[model samples]
Target: MHRVKSDLLSAHIGSKPSKTWRAICDGIDVLKQGLIKRIGDGATTLIWACNWIPRTGIFRPIASKVPEPPVLVSELIDHTSMTWKAELVRNCFFDFDSDVILQIPLSMRKQEDFWAWHHETNGLFTVCSAYRMLVETKKNREDYFGSCGNCSDVQRIQKEWKHLWRMKMPSKIKVFCWRLAHNSLPTGSVLKNKNLANTANCKICGAEEDTWIHSLLQCNISKCVWALMDEDLLDLLASLRFSDPKYWVSYICCNIPQADGIRILVTCWAIWYARRKAIHEGIFKSPFSIMIMINRLIEEFEFVQGIDFKEKDLYQEKSRTHNWIAPQNGLSKINTDAAIDRTGTKGVVAAVCRNDQGGFIAASAMVIPHITDPETLEAMACLEALAFAEDCGIRSFVVALDCLNVVKNIREMP
Candidate 1:
């Protein structure tokens, strides 16, 4: 049986009279040798015997299809050389009629030919069919993979996929690049690369070199602003013995006590605002001006929250020393004033106790705002004075107010 199988197999392989058939026979011989190595001599012989083929089927297909056989068939022959190539084309031609390859019409025979050639050359037909099966499994997620607008629009999802593949981005930067590409960041509008012509020099300093990082921090003008801010902040930080920016920010935020976090935020925001003004508006102001602007911004932020920095600092100092008190005679002179400005609107209430020489012994100011009515403002002022007195360890003190309505309100209180 083994001898008969080998004779029949050789005859069938040789009778085909084609290079493809010869190559297939060579592959089978290699496979048989591999099987012999694994399964031993008798098992290999049995395998060959079970796998033999007749010569009839092999020659009939080509002989019936072609009028005459070639002298020597080439292994590098094109697809047209195959007897079944026309039948394969016909099957794919009708397959396209079923509305497959939906984007490309069936009338595009050239495109169909290119696709078939690609499949055959790259051996991707099976892989693509498997991918189609996986895609069909995700039919529920079809909406996400749909076109941007109406199906009639010329926009193709395939083009976007091809572009994305060509980008070859690292996984870490991919999402960030996607957001940037989609114009989704807060700075996205300002961060445009219009053209090579539009981006010649730094707009602020007229420097020939201009880049994102340069415009942000490294440019001469930006560096000057940062240097001045760093100097002041570094001085304050040195006094606190914190050298690093992170440590300085943390120290100021934690130790400064009142509205320190808000102050830090305002300071940073002011610095960026100044840089933007310089770049966009071409306003090259002094570093001192920027610092002043930061101070004003901080004041504005505090004012909106009904507070003042200077008065707050003084009050905190007095609160720490236990010196915000009335006179020993149970009489306190309260001076109330309101500081109203575009940046801030706050009412100040100060309690003072003078010595025999008319020098101030104890004084305190309460800074609070959002006062709509004059009477309520004065009452709040007196209350602030009394609270200061109580905080300074003074239990009994006479409260004085310039407003008669405030005086009347305090007297009428049970």
Candidate 2:
């Protein structure tokens, strides 16, 4: 080990004056900058060369045009006590670098300088950090995404993520929009790329890749849906020409009025939904029917927004009779339900368990890929509730189900 270390230091760090070893020397020089000093006695670390700041990484402060002799970390600290020499630091560093250096508190006593990996938060060396350092140096770029030239637009798109959430829609719809913007929608092409599908063809038309543009705008089905809307709306959507979904969506959302933009978003989401129905459930709705549904939902939401919900709640309070019954002491009750598609090929089973006094406990939800029978779905929900209760270490729990036949079947079980 000693011989190996000697060979490496002599060949790279120290002088091995040969043209063949030039590349190795250059590599070692680049590697040295990635090493950060932990700031102890400050004797070994050079003030300008070493990276010591926790927040700023390895930023060198330039106070002079001509470089001077290297200053050691120890020279910046007062030897009488473990405190920074503010005057020396000010002379050597700019205000910001001096502030960062001074912010690093010294140890109770002087100790040996310790080196750490600057790229990682935990100060541990990792291959990932080494690869990143190499890539950054080779590319000679400081942008967040070093390799991609068009990353500036991507960064801009990220800023508008909040716009999707701001829309007056369900949380699920917002997530759908977010996924669409990211081009992460599990269309046929995406599924094929993931090896989950045999081909990248459109599930509805089986022509070309099921890209975001084709699935949402260019497909015959989508075109038919757009034809049902007003000519002005169709023109507005047609005017979008961006190949990237995020850029396209951002352009429309920012340029068009919010009301009209929301309608477009709703239509896009509905188109994706109809495609999913056709793919997973073998159920297809006509483009005209999909448009009607979208308009109905928008009108309903707008109408409900204008109504006095407080008065409706008051009326409900006066007429309400059905109420949840609490379980007995030392026992828990679980309510389970499944929301299944019309064709029964896909559904989500959810279970929520609560204590006797209705205090929240544990809950679980599972997405079933396929369940032919609705009754089987109810059974799966019951089983999911039991499994969740067991996982929570709840021994005594009553399983509640809305289906009476399911409840009777459970009671009749041995």
Q: List lDDT for all candidates, in order.
A: 0.41, 0.72
Give the residue spans of candidate 1 off by over 4 A.
1-197, 206-213, 230-272, 275-282, 306-414
lDDT of 1 at 164: 36
Q: Which pairs of residues clash in candidate 1, taking residues 3 or more apart in a chain or in different chains?
A: none
Taking the tens digit of each residue's C-alpha lDDT, what string does model 1 give over 1-414?
112256433535644356766676765553332121111111122211332111111111122123332221121112242111233223333332212111111110111111121111121234454444346435524744674332321124333434433332233233433333343322312333544354456666676655433443456655665566546443553365432333333344334534443444454445456666765697766768877876776666566656555454322434334344444553444445333334433344456645333455477665443223345455556655656666676555455556775566455544
lDDT of 2 by residue, 171-275 (tens): 777788779878899987888989998999997888879888889988989999988877877888777788888888776566666667767888989999999
List residue ranges in candidate 2 displaced over 4 A: 1-158, 306-414
Question: What's the distance in Å from true for residue 394, model 1?
Answer: 38
Compare the candidates by lDDT and give the number of the best one. Answer: 2
Q: For candidate 1, report its TM-score.
A: 0.24
